[model samples]
Target: MSGLIGRLRGRGRPPFAALAAGLGLAALSLSACGGGDAPPANVVATGSAPSYYPADYAQVINASKGEGGTLTIYSNTDQENWAPIFHDFQKKYPWVKKISANNLDSDEVFQRVLSEQATSGSPADLLVSNAAQAWAEFAAKPNALMAYKSPELAKLPKFAQLLPNVYAMSVDPLSAVYNKTLIDQQPDTLQGLADLVAKDQGKYRDKITTRDVKGSFGFTVSHAFTSARPGSWAALQKILPLARPETSSGTQLEKITSGEYVAGFFISAAPAYPVAAKSGGLLKITFLKDGTVVLPRGVGIAAKAPHPATSKLFADFLMSQEGQRAVAEGGLTSYRGDVETRKDRHTYQELVSKVGESNVIFARYAEVPGAEVNAFVSRWNGLLGH
Candidate 1:
């Protein structure tokens, strides 16, 4: 995995004027408009994303004229830490300008990308994001993304695959999260939490938590449910009344930490617990037995990027030691087996071992629209009733 990113929803649209020179913000704006009834075109469509990088793509892109230029980045990387990565990239491609679509969530990022696609504005050349499903279409589906490969990708693990265009950069485990001290004892897996609720219904009733069936956290939960217990989501319907899923993962985490409820879910496996524990927060989690449930981050270049050369350079930079280290500094985990940072490699290994390598659908959202997630969310909303 190249860029196993974090979660956010409808959050990534910045000011149109500030987006980039020459392009209007019409494409970048997030509108809850009607999506195409049919899922996006597949790879066979006129312009499918690159599943296999051409041998000389890097040579050509790196050798291009606009060697020193700035390219817009639609991402969720925190400013405080990402500065170093940008700075390092600048060192490599001093001529290229690097701008981040900060504070924007995954949905907003996708919306902006789509908007750009429609307006014929050069979509952000580099998309450093975590929403695998959103961009899957561009890589394998028709006319979604252009095909181009970078030599850097070859260094990553085979499991970190998200089509050829996208990279599985980082990793996170969907553990059985809980606020510390809330639950008397920490169970070993998600089933433990359910059992806790079943045995001590009074304690967790209405106070328990999970993500709304909207974001990736809940999405991960759904995948896990489907795999472990085919009909578990339906079973969860019985317990929905007790679950207080919030609109956002950040919110879900905050509620559990404040002791408004005892136990809830959180990403990141055992190694990350210390970070949460540093705050002296009441939180903990465990891995399931059967399959490893992990969340890998991925990203790819826009098929119609304005700065083609810059895009390749940027992606290459990301795959480099400097870029990888920069991302690691953001306190995230990557699927790259040989991440540049020493500490992150250890942290990543710890999480995967505990939670298990998660069930990841590379670039499925943008490609296979209704396969697993759409039906799941629809049923979930019916059960949750908003």
Candidate 2:
């Protein structure tokens, strides 16, 4: 839910770089390598389709080939984070000529679709975001999202399906990120961090940062953390006063890396882990011991998609085994059990195993009761002294 995390210049090897090298850009020059089994220029290779695919899946693929082979998406994710998955999608469906993903605020993903659809018709074939409440609101709107049940739907956890059509793009955990040079003692839980700050009040004051709960992502993560453990409020009360509330994950990570801020909590792991992997021992992160909140980024096709057939193909691809692997490679946490765990790259399966199922707090798709949301935000602002 890092709504404002734009192009990142991480020091590590670009995600999926190896895969891209091995695959080469053969799709662009398919005719150069003559293969007897190759599908026609416009159609996908039916023989290569997964066995789990629907019987009529070939029809969907062929239909997409005739429908202009382009897709437009409204999402909160940066293109760099999506490059691996996009690369794989294009490689699989060589006919797809363009993929336009506009990065926006989580809530804006829905707003843009709704606004455009009501007027000149939204160009969005798909929409992706982590704003749970906004997704709930959009679902309430008639014909907002197409009800396309993917073949991979049954393979995913029930919770992965946010609504009839919306699905979790990635299941990411909220974690605490700290600068190794700034703090001698590393705490694994929010309460421990609070205790550490209280021990040296003067040194820690204004040195901790977190998401501002006024925004959707910030509010969702914080609310889930607090709700999962009521006693966490005691810890937050001590921490928030001495902390600065940031509107973006990128800024929090940047300031922490530069030592301007010593630590940050309820930070998104999707972006944090990849950056930490290449921080040269400067940045470190820990899943909260008391309760780790798992936020699932949601994706779905638009009801009035300009490229519905292509959108359907892309949606199915996202939930497939290969797609999930690309998702993890691209730095987003994959939830599929089959996706193997790698250094710095996390999967929801590993998170559940690490934290114990009880401590893995899932941020559900439903809107938090309006009255409850208002109360939570009010108290959160109070603790921040805002």
Residue 242, candidate 2: alpha-carbon lDDT: 88
Local error of candidate 1 at 355, Å?
A: 3.8
Cα RMSD (angstroms) for every candidate in the order listed: 10.8, 6.8
Instruction: Give the per-residue lDDT of model 2 (tens digit) for 151-227.
Output: 88878888779877889889889888999999979998888998999898889888999887777788788888787
Q: Which candidate's TM-score is highest?
A: 2
Compose the digit string of candidate 1's lDDT tens values, residues 130-197.
55555553355455555766566577666555677776545555555666676777766545556667
Instruction: Judging by lDDT against the true structure, name the best candidate.
Output: 2
Angstrom error of the Cα, residue 233, model 2: value is 1.2
- How much lDDT does each candidate structure score? 0.52, 0.76
The C-alpha TM-scores of every prediction are: 0.72, 0.87
Candidate 2, 340: how far from true, in Å?
A: 0.8
Count of clashing residue pairs in every prediction: 45, 0
Q: In candidate 2, what residue range of length 10 has the lowest lDDT sum?
A: 4-13
